[model samples]
Target: MFLTPAERIADYQARGWWEEIGVDALLRQAVAERGATLALVDPLNRKTLDGCAPERLSWNELDARVDAMAAALIALGLERDDVICAQLPNTVDAVILFLAVARLGLIISPIVMQYREHELGHILSLTDARAFVTVPTFHGHDYAAMAAALIAERPGMMLLTMGAAPHGADLRALAASADPASVAPWCAAHPVAGGEVLTICWTSGTEARPKGVPRDHNHWVLNAKVIVWGTGMQPGDVLLNPFPLVNIASIGGLMLPWLEVRGTMVLHHPFDLSVFLKQIEAEHVTYTIAPPAVLTALLKQPQIAASVDLSSLRAIGSGSAPLTPWLIEGWAETHGIEICNIFGSNEGMALMSSPIDVPDRTERAHYFPRFGAEGVDWDSPVSAVMRTRLVDPETGAIITEPGRPGEMHISGGTVISGYWRSPELNGASFDGEWFRTGDLFEIAGDGALSRFYRFVGRSKEIIVRGGVNISPAEIDELLVSLPGVREAASVGIPDSDLGERIAVAVVVDDGITPPDVAAVGAHLAAAGVAVFKRPERLVVLSALPRNAMNKVVRADLRAAVLAALES
Candidate 1:
């Protein structure tokens, strides 16, 4: 169901958080103004995926493809509000399909490339999707066979394959068959409202089954505004996007911003540092988004740093983990690029520390000045639209004092009403209008107006040793500062005497020996970390286990540590 209520829609529109125009309207405007400009550049397709030349589409060309696809979908009997599940990679076809869905007023559900039978089956069953779009094969997985098996269970579902139509209809043929002259008339007849649900994106499912998050055009537009304002994005900026297209990071962080600015977007699927760096140099990318771990790794490689021409990059947005101070400062000092610490979720909670807002590199690593803080306001467009607060988990009291950890709660135009079609999750996910973020944060700074907040790990992730509660983020932050440590994650392991003991898993830099547990403890002690909070056990690996979003899976790390301990 669509989240924004009628009254809320009126309010947001009145306040400029949302405009009356939809995303298609924006794209149309871009075509009218800058039709000849390069809208999308897909280099991955040239080198890896298709073995063809790189694909570059201008606004005019992209618009035509979108219309052709829309006409094709309409001809296939998919009407307004029909659901289409797309399991494609970051390719031109995926982009065209999304625009077509929006144009035809159909609900587009983008599944991550990593989803296998179990997850895809659950989503297909839940959505009762009328049409499924996928590649014949991706990364050696036979998707055509998989789609054939899935449609065998639900015979009504239509299968549309990108490469070949071994399972069902070929999408390439469908798009080619459609008459572009009839597309505008078809779209005009089936216009989508700004408040209509446009997408159903699934969560990462770290804790439980992935929940579908339905977002409207307004929700997406508002989120894009937040990213644009927070990141200080300018018109005609060149952005190198390596994030997957299924989530808010791609939609809000890259897609929306590109649409907003009418800029060039260079897409790189399956992130490769060498390729990503080459794109930055070749395309003269002005901005891009990366995980903190990737940024840290890039900064460590001297040859990579020297070889790549990063002069065009103005800023890099990073988060989804605790950003090390050294990494943030190092990028700024060495590469002359600012690292904007962005903390956001698929559920629409956003907190960013941009160089323009938080100039101090160390402060940028830890604090995000609460948007809409009382009596203090920045020039950000999202400042007046979004509200945030911290509340004590046990007492349910609002936290005003510094250094006390509390769960972050957010409310704004960007925040969705609830999970799609899941009443139980909807009931548990909100406290009145504010969405409970599940992330623990501590209020910092002095005075009511000057107060900011710092992320303090997740509520369920705190390690308890005896009776003392220790934040793994605090320990991880300290340990990452060690000389040879590339990545670090701390977890609690079972211990008979103390109930649980602090354990750390690290990915040491190549050619460097990992520090012993005692050495780690000594470093923490020297850094003034509490003895109770220090990690008692250490496990070294070549790399940390990361999800498709490039976020470290701590549950996996905990399990790996436990298995190692058992062995």
Candidate 2:
């Protein structure tokens, strides 16, 4: 359970970059000081999303829920170091589950609601989780049934559903039966430490099965600290979180930061623009994160954007890439809201382009503050502890000059030591002390501006559509498995509104009936692929372009598909 080395923990703690208090402690502090303040919220359309009414909980209310859930979990015979898999919508209940696990020294690996059996099976096998927590139904999907079938495969693994379930345990009923006051003794006896692993978030790359990324309490808290320092978040600031709370984009960036600042968290699962704007206006939100494409599309519609009052909002964060200079300036000039560019991954690659650092809206749209640079000081606290160097992927030579694209080597207090239990992946991912971020970046600007890092592209062939990372290899492998498909390649097509959309090109066998777009979509659907990962466009090719290794040339396929779609 102790993933970080003792020396590194001591080193970071001595440097004053990471705190001794864990997330559980942070929640306790918030409950102690801000007991009467509103601290958590359910999505506005909670009844439609999960068949439950919306909830607004103060700090004490949230604390009581956490205690009740923890006590219920303990009564069910769960113990320390047990891994729990959670698949729920963004709601107050989800946040309570997260805290309950942290309080009991348990590791929670949260997956997005989009995941089906194809994803859950692999995660359950990897974590060997003791339990699964989700609603009985979400978006009309029978999640309770899915959990029932999956849990049956592994004997002794329990299923806990938020709503009533015929086949599994009811989480709400269990919490209602348990006494919250009985949990304090158990928590004190268990004593969760800052270095113990708190969460194992999954990420996909070239591998078909997702890789588990384990983060200890100190690491996640440190990740949140970077967000707090960059944004200048103060106590009582309201945060509207629209991203999935599963990964770094939501958890590390917004959730933990909300705990740090003792603010009210407005939960939203994204893509509901009207509800999002409503929550912002109603909560008088001070900060929120949104996708660049969504923000851009909204900006184009002046009337829709004008419908809500965003005067309380000071700044908004959008994650890496797709941020045009005009997009940043448009929001600022029109609404007095600053758009901050955030560069990070679940593996703990952290960078932020805040107004205080870049000042110029144009530069802030594209560049992130280069942390840990010598002789170049930054206002952010993360800048002092992080060490970054751009290295040529082929030659292993470090590139310090501007305009050259190279793989980023990041070493810091919060960077993960390695992936969860994958020795081969760890060997490939970590170079001594530094984690190799497959995303390519360049050093930009002159003099003071030279302290900024610009994102050019990613070395990995992962398609990011609507801020969700999808591995093209997974799509390609699935496509080639279907009948008549001899070779298949998937690539991201640029979109004005979606950042990118999946496009596929297939070469069918001779004399075999070639599948059309509809047929291809049907095949993916039958295989339990997530809707977002399915191809938006499909093209038939006699032969896919390839190099000497015989691997499909994705670049060539992408160009052909783009032309075909345009035509």
lDDT of 2 by residue, 269-305 (tens): 6458899999899999999988787788788888998
Q: Rate the local accuracy (lDDT) of all candidates.
A: 0.80, 0.86
In terms of TM-score, which candidate is strongest? Answer: 2
Clashing pairs in 1: none
| Most accurate candidate by lDDT | 2
The 10 consecutive residues of candidate 2 with the worst lDDT sum are 372-381
Candidate 1 structure lDDT: 0.80
- Please state the error at residue 270 of candidate 1 in Å: 0.9
Kindly list the per-residue Cα lDDT of model 1 for residues 1-567, writing each as its tens digit. 356688878887898878856788778888898999899998654546643466899999999999889878978888788889998878788888988887777899998776666567878998899999988887777877887788889978999987664688888788888887877787777777788888999773223345788989888877877888899999999998886678888887898888888888998888788889999999999999987667877778767778989999999998766677898889988989999988887778788999888888988998887886555577766678888888899999988777889999998888888788888877877886799888888877577424568887666665655423456665666777887888888888866446479898888767889888998888876764445667888988777878999876777888998887778
